[model samples]
Target: MWELIQSNRRKSLILFFGMGALLILIGYVFGSYYDPEAGGVVGVFFAIVLWVILSALSYFAGSKILLAVSGAKEVTKDVHPQLYNVVEEMKIAAGVPFFPKIYIIDDPAPNAFATGVKPENSAIAVTSGLLSTLNRYELQGVVAHEMSHIVNRDILLMTFAGVMLGVITIMSDIFFRGMYFGGGSRYRSRSSSKSSGQAQVIVMILAIILAILGPVLAQLFYFAISRKREYLADASAARLTRYPEGLANALEKIANSTHKLRSANKVTAPMYIVNPLKREGMKLADLTSTHPPISERIKILRALQQGVSYNDYQRVFEMIHGKKEKIIPDSVLKESIAVTPVIGLTNEDKDFNPIEARREANDAVMKLNDYNFINCKCGVKIKIPPDYNKPIVVCPRCGTRHQLR
Candidate 1:
């Protein structure tokens, strides 16, 4: 997990420098052609300020904005007791400081994700289909996987990667806009010599090329970073649960599930546990994907279930790609291996008491309600008039019609 964090931080830094350099080059070209006297300084300053302001805004409010855009609604225990219980259990096992807000989308897709700048301020959202489809153990595994993202700070890393990509795209667009709008008119005032005029035209052509290609190059970098983080998050989640079978089974189920999320789009698809966009049949050569291949992920998890270390996993991945494996520090490897799994209820275990779970659930529900209803399975609280001998009861959640006994 630490190695993943370090790798993401390094990538962010490199991209930051790369963007600054690209902006500087574009500014230099623009100044040379249009305002030779002050172009370099103006371009560099503009790039710096733009990068700083944009990055800062994304760092603080990006997660909230993303949740709102995704149409995720905040849920409480009253809304979904089962999901709240699972998330609470996972958060305890992961050693996260505060329990993240839980939410459920109305979509049928079996997908879930975690988002926030930090664990303390985080939230997790899952589809209604995920709840209805997977069994309890499988659901626990999926929730654990998302909690691993929070524990490892994957949300923050991915957010920065997106910001870098966005900045590059903006810079490229600005260059093209300037070219098209005759911002190059300043070039005529820069030089009256024939050679200088020719130089101006050459600079303009180069600027246009850079502008056209910059976004594509930036996107490639963003995708590379995203793919690597997915792998890292998988390994971290495996370590967190210590029972790779649970997550592996969940992944297989998701791949086979027919449900597709209506709210998911290209922007939010990468955030899901599985690609909620349902691109499971796409070929491996489509490397520009926001997610790694599900088959490949399943294979890795199966290997981990057989007690494969992360070092060996990295080696296998590198061999397959024909590239040198990233050498993670021993300390980080040790920490990843140290996460203990939560002890959950099992069919054979005497401790697997449904009654106790129900009691706990009921207690949690009672605490959430201000005025408790005397008779209702849905757990809603409603006041009954004194003259009413037998009042009709309605459950807001399950919608069961009944009368007070």
Candidate 2:
């Protein structure tokens, strides 16, 4: 698991530098077209600054934006006591400082995901269907897998990669817009006095080609980074739980489920435990995918369950998937595999009402829709429908009336 972390960290840095280089190159070329030496200097600076600002924003706010776009609502222990307990226990096992917020989506699809800038600010969300369908052990396996993502900071790496991709896309758009809008007019005016029309045509042709290829190259880079992170997260999860079968079972269940999550779309699809954008008749190995095939992931986990070491797992993964596993150190692997004691149910549990638990889950889902309150200011908690959109809601806490934004 440590190896996965180190490898992804290295990859993230490489991508950052690669993106910086691309931006600098584009800036220099465009700048030189206007003023040979001075323009190149200015362009490099502009590119660096633009990349830095955008990267920072993505690092801090990307996960929040993703959650909002996916329509996830936060929940508390009172709302989803089992889920909160599971996540909290995993957080302790991972030895992270802050526990990730828990969230529930109304979809019937059995799926879940983890997201945040870092473990401290992270969150784990699951579909209502997942909670209803998965048994306790199976649910622990799923939560543990997502917690692994938090520990390894995969979310941060993904966010950074996304930022770089965004930068490249924006740069490409600017290049194209400049070309189409006659940004070269001043250069043309100056060059026309000293050069032939053929030279001018050559410059425009080269500029147009660069404009078109820039975004394409950026997209390829984005796809490559996204795919790699998914693989790394899978390996990390397996190492963390030390019970690959648990996660494997969860994946199998997700694959078998037919319900599609209503809120999922192309942009937020990659963040899901399963590809929520169900593609009918599509096999797992199709080239156009943000996630690896579920079958492939299960195959790898099953192999791990048979006493395979991390190195051996990597070898098998590469043989089957054609991608190298990031080399994780023994110490990190041991640390990640560490588990906390499970809270065993006692005979006293019989005193608690199962019907009440069901009611709580239902009410929580309903409260989520009426308002996004995970915790109330009045100290009393409430749950609502996932799709409820009333303008006013009475807080169960203190009976205060709160207006929806």
TM-scores, one per candidate: 0.78, 0.75
Cα lDDT of model 2 by residue, 1-405, tens digit: 455568667867887788767767777666555554376687667767888898777677777887787678898786677888888777776666788899898777778988997777889999887876665556777898788777777787777766766766676677667667866635555555445456556555665665677667766777666665566666656655556666777788888888888888776777777777855235633455777678887887776644434555566587776765554444544544333322232233345454654555666686565545544686765544446688778876477787766
Task: Please give, for residues 32-113, the per-residue lDDT of candidate 1 as tens digits.
Answer: 5556557757766776677778778878887787677767767777656778888888887767678888866655567888
What lDDT would candidate 1 get against the real structure? Answer: 0.68
- Taken over the whole model, the C-alpha lDDT of each candidate is 0.68, 0.69
lDDT of 2 at 221: 70
Residue-level error in angstroms, candidate 2, position 100: 1.2
Candidate 1 has a TM-score of: 0.78
Clashing residue pairs found in predicted model 1? none
Every model's Cα RMSD, please? 6.1, 7.2
